[model samples]
Target: MAGRWVKPEVFPLFAAVGAVVGLCSMQLVRNICTNPEVRVTKENRSAGVLQNFEEGEKYAQHGLRKYVRGRRPEVMPNLNKFFSDPK
Candidate 1:
């Protein structure tokens, strides 16, 4: 079986399978070429919402500022009372 040519009966089967595969590939190519919706274009491509890194950084900075503004004086009060402590 190593070097034997394909049997005559099997040759027709192989040809039929090859023809079906070729027709399927041709139809796939034609569908891709004829269908505008299936084609890749800039308008159809999704513009990812997270594409802007700088805008995200700005929002983070604004949030941090708001967070710090609420607790700045409460967390870091003036230290002048240390020397004025009555002992």
Candidate 2:
């Protein structure tokens, strides 16, 4: 003997409409709370600020080295004689 399945009368009326509404509401709530745990780790959030400053100092010194190498002033120039152009 097999048991007969009974479908509730209320289900026939609201099933399609209820399913659509419930799923849409579920998606809305899911999107609202998606990234619920807002967190910034110790390393990720602030590492760049200080690190970039330090790296900038290094880069400045590197450029300074090149500039100083190309254009360097001597200790003293003989002001009296050099003024006269030997033509």
Provide TM-scores for the models: 0.42, 0.27
lDDT of 1 by residue, 48-84 (tens): 3335566455644664587786664553355645655
Off by over 4 Å in 2: 1-11, 35-87
CA-lDDT, candidates in order: 0.63, 0.56
Alpha-carbon runs more than 4 Å astray in model 1: 2-5, 41-87
Q: What is the C-alpha RMSD of each candidate to the true structure, in Å?
A: 25.1, 29.2
Candidate 1 accuracy as TM-score? 0.42
Candidate 2 lDDT, 1-87, residue by residue in tens: 222333476566668879899999976764454322322565554555443556455544564577777653754445534775574
lDDT of 2 at 74: 50
Best candidate according to TM-score? 1
